[model samples]
Target: MSLPADLCERTLNRILAAHPDLVEQETPLASLTSPMSPAPVGSVRVFKGSAVAKVVYVGLVVPMIQLDSHMIFAFTPEDSAVPHFTLDSVYGGAYHAFHLDLIPRADLASHLPYLDAAFHPLSPVFESAAGIEGLTPAAIGPRQRAIMSPWMLVNRASEEAFAAITEHVDAYAAHWSGLVDKGLPDDVLAGLADTDLAARDTAVRANIFSRDVDPVWAQVSRLLGDETTDAIRAELVANG
Candidate 1:
């Protein structure tokens, strides 16, 4: 529970450093507050880079810091076919859940080079992380498998497990930073407009928009009201 707050700040700092051009772009969710307290329950911002894509982060933090929910997603410019980063985490009580990956624009299995570059470098670290109870290997379940690459780290972990998880988080950050610095290739950029890649990418990001099953929303709503919960969901999918 305590880790999510620090993780949120650390993740944002790492991303800003990785993409220096990122500016604080506002969204409708900033004004919304938790029904439980006067202070804003959550915030949404766009981190836009000059050369790379615009990355958006939606963070929800509780007063006692008992429950924290945050997601950081990257949306590439229309002309780039690169996979954008996706990192979502929720911490409450003795449990924590994680979803981290460089979501592929297309089928992950079809992109061997990208997988090797992103996942292979961090493969050795996975064994130690798997030692946790709820977390298995890289992936599981159909929906996760479809959206996340096989190299991604998706699991539910105990609070104690999070200490080790930071290493995995740092590894993913390094890979993402490298990708942001590299940009896309000429051949991929050339065909981007001709293909429906941008549309596909947007649709993929839309999955996080509603997220009806998210327990954080229910908790926030119980503390606040329906309006606050609805605002959080809408701003998550909103474009900068």
Candidate 2:
């Protein structure tokens, strides 16, 4: 479906007005003819300078749409230089992780009116056949549900804190693997591998065990219960 032109203009104008730092220049459809020319039709480019003006695509725009229909935000030197405004936010959040496709630049203004009328306090619409309801933690399996609970809580705590926890998890896994490579005893390696089970076991005297882990697990446990946890734990134990 083609987005309304006036609404697109208004939304763009509003966003531009809200963030005065972004320099907005319209690249007329006729001006682009070469590789720079927007693929197919009904596509527009919003440029600050020599760097890629955001490429806005209205619905399927031919050869490119065969690859992906969603609009794309191509970053330029000017865009990179800015510290605060990231390509993600400008493009409507992280691309791959969230699978959030860029709203067509041409349709940004147009979509806003529909968004305002339909959705409450419209934000960036993530492109997914599985909508927010599908992505909700309750919809996932036990382990994933547990991890997501803590991640969401930590994310709410602070972005920096959340980043630190993620880094720690990565580092912890690497450190554990390195120990195994260095000929750590099988028992020790087994201990390292079973951190989650150890975390759950109240009788274990492991230093890594923390009460904090339970709250997150509890949320998942409440959803999936002990049976599922025990089943997963049995699989892990058998695999080990």
Candidate 3:
């Protein structure tokens, strides 16, 4: 059983390296622990960059770095037509799933630039990812399905499969960084706010981090202490 702790670090390091200018915001809950473990359960970081968006990362791993518990990266709105840059992966015991995607701010079908860059180029490989279960492409809606790309994988993984997952994650993180690197002009951002974008943004985020929809709420709370864990979730799903 190989520990993929470096995988989580690789993703975080990639984001920080890719955007040297991002501000690392201080958070009270930087680290959390698992109820039954010696090392921390996971760690979290928040970064504020240019007009593009704010980046948030939360990751969990075993002390040996052998068992990657969970790793998540979310890039949220503040600038131009962009979806949240999100990546979710988990490998522990016999549970394995790999999901890497840029969730469209709205509908994927109409978000042409995103569609052209993220989906069209990568979907074929992702769609056919080997040994991945539940790699279903369904119509996006207000549910968790809304934020997922058709290529997202949910299955038991193999060694070769894990390696493939790591490679895709690295590339996809770079892909999302490029999309939001320059960000949109301030004037452009202000113009888009006319639709009460703030309210919508908050709602969209809450939907993403809401405990009702959180898969690891219980696990995280037990590990980090309910209060601290909830605070982290609040930060991730914050409103305008």
Candidate 4:
């Protein structure tokens, strides 16, 4: 398996082990093959649980385009204010890009308590990983970056640098698992109503998955067709 595939697998394993109650869900996208490629090109799987509304994992390898990618989106219950977990690693041609983030459920600027409680613990690891050699900023535009957390690590890296970030990735995943178990502090949750939390989560998710907000989906649509791409998006934003 490729380095990115291995990292994604291990991170997913950790999440599964931490939450044994998770139940796998059926998906129409279980097997993906495009006419552009001879063999299977991609696959999607979904899981649901008490803490998680839906967890979507996707793998795509297109030999024709020299693209290898693995990504996961673990969304929390709409009623809860817990942030979502997302990781995407792709190797295209000679370059490699990986994105790791805990998608924020609230506006960090206005909700200081939520921001601190949920993301402060990751600051050290985020900063340290940023200093790693051979890691340059990714091609993602500022518009797309604005929707995610500030702690997001999205960068193109050399082979060595890509391998070096595995530990940091594990650290981020571990912190997210802790968040799932302990949840937000009482002070933070007390300030927000469950209805408001669900509303914000829905709005944010809609924006994140919007093709106008994220151009990547356009590329996906071209490869997998609009119908299939929308199905994948629906799985990612499904409200359990």
Candidate 4: clashing pairs of residues:
none
lDDT of each: 0.65, 0.26, 0.61, 0.87
The 10-residue segment with the lowest total lDDT in model 3: 133-142
Q: What ordering of candidates by lDDT runs from best to worst?
A: 4, 1, 3, 2
Ten residues in sequence with the least summed lDDT for candidate 2: 82-91
TM-score of 3: 0.75
Write down the worst ten-residue block by lDDT for model 1: 208-217
TM-score winner between candidates 1 and 3? 1
Q: Between 1 and 4, whose lDDT is larger?
A: 4
List, residue by residue over 83-172, the lDDT tens digit for candidate 1: 667787877665787777776665545555545654566676655667765553333456646665666777777677765688778877
Per-residue lDDT of candidate 2, residues 1-240 (tens digit): 212222233334433443345554443432222232344333333534222223232211233322112222322222111101111111112111111211111112333332232221112221222232222222223543232211121111122322223222233223322322343344433333423332222122121112243343353234335554333223212111
lDDT of 1: 0.65
Q: Rank the candidates by TM-score, best first.
A: 4, 1, 3, 2
Error of 3 at 231 (Å): 0.8
Q: Compared to the true structure, candidate 4 yields what TM-score?
A: 0.96
For TM-score, the strongest prediction is 4
Q: How accurate is candidate 4 locally (lDDT)?
A: 0.87
Residue 238, model 3, lDDT: 59
Question: Per-residue lDDT tens digits of candidate 3, residues 170-227?
Answer: 6667666766675544554444544444566666677767777756677677666788
How many clashing residue pairs are found in candidate 3? 1
- Residue ranges of candidate 3 with Cα displaced over 4 Å: 1-3, 34-39, 62-67, 110-114, 128-143, 182-197
